[model samples]
Target: QVTFSHCVPTIVQMLLNAKAAQGTDFKGWKITIGGSALTRGLYDQAKARGMNLIAAYGMSETCPLISGAHINDELLKADEDTRSTFHLKAGVPVVLVDAAIQAADGSFLPADGSSQGELVLRAPWLTQGYYNEPEKSEELWADGWLHTGDVAVIDEMANIEIRDRIKDVIKTGGEWLSSLTLEGLISRHEAVRDVAVVGVPDERWGERPFALVVLGEGRELSAAELQAFLEPAVAEGHINKWAIPQQIAVVSEIPKTSVGKLDKKRIRSEIARWQKEGSAEQTSLS
Candidate 1:
């Protein structure tokens, strides 16, 4: 029998959910998940099916190996909830690399788990330039740190929790909200298999979170139900009350980029086109 195999979390998940195996044949299979944030929902689903999967975080610039959650005695002794919290993080930096979160003003933030900032890193093995693009290369290495552009919070234990991209973070009513956080919460619904949240412009609030969700096979859900599902997160203080998305649309699938990241730019453009067409229809009816 093959002792191990590896692939993206998405592919592993799809294989595990296949009807032929009845979810039992994949036991003890080893997988390395990367290229995107592996949400708790997918993690739990894979675990329940008896697959051994791990979360890793990095980029092409760093040669793609930064942090990985390796289960140890303490992690193995922890409860499911505790273990999931640790598993969901990007884990500590690997050997020879330095990672830290820095405030917008270039000040370093504490790794107490709540202070949000952009993740900056320095490593000898990291890529130097962008193929003759000196300006972009300079921007990438501004202040001698490789600005990853990823917004994250680091716990006292040094586990990195990626909150969202700096450009994707939603600012509405003078508050900054993490689209990644919202997407994670919404994916907890039984009917939701995947989700993507993007910030869209608003006249009154400056910007709002818009969600596109993919439902599980044979599952049905309503936008209001999805909104209701997130209401408790607001009360629990995981998110601001107003941070609950005003727009939750059920879609067959969320779009991804060439490297399998959520394509927010295209999504925003699509939403703008829809809003324009909707306005034209309303004007015609009037």
Candidate 2:
């Protein structure tokens, strides 16, 4: 009975699960996904269910408007495979919003689609500061631009593709790994119902990626199985072998924030506690 909906990627995923359980037809649902990165795996699943899904980008600070997946005449005429390449991106900035990527050295990076850095914005509608929080406000608008805290890259067409959050990006073996990318790849597995990857402290590598996964009903998955599944991605140079999670635990649930985004902070604490108590299933490659 729903014609249109606007929600985060998590909500779209939940709706897909509901549709499967209820066996309902959603051939004409127009759903816009915002608030977080939309993975290709989720997009494919939603498409298979006949849901018309689109990706968007914004934050509470920007009056919740910035970019979206633009489907123009050419895009509309293209096949799903061709359309998804553009649809999965954050798209060009909306009118009045100037977007840029700032590197760690404070230099503005190029919009070459490969230079990843913190996404900064300048728009008339952006929030100026936190209420009664001068220090935080100052940080938010450092160098006269609102810092979004999201690491992203911009292509020649001005499309923005969010890579990962600054705090959540994993630094292992002197290379940065996008947790979002890892999760997206993991979610492609047929047995994976939900997945979250976090970087845990490691002595030799500085930090190692750990994954927590939830399997579909009556399905089973193991760390070895997942690594085997991801081998092709590594072979194809989508990710390095070291980027493969050193540990994976199948859990009944992955915690979520009030708004339904994955609660990575709580997940980190849970992993710590689980390791301390020897309850976590430790699956590591030799």
Error of 2 at 155 (Å): 0.5
lDDT of 1 at 51: 70
Q: Quote model 1's TM-score.
A: 0.92
C-alpha lDDT of residue 43 in model 1: 80
The sequence of per-residue lDDT tens digits that candidate 1 reaches over residues 50-163 is 776677789889997888776678889998888887777788888888889999999999999999999999999998889979998998898889999899988877788888
Clash pairs (backbone) in predicted model 1: none
Instruction: Kindly state the number of residue pairs that clash in model 2.
Output: 0
Highest lDDT scorer: 2
Q: What lDDT does the true structure give each of the candidates? A: 0.81, 0.87
Distance from true location, Cα of 75 in model 1, Å: 2.6
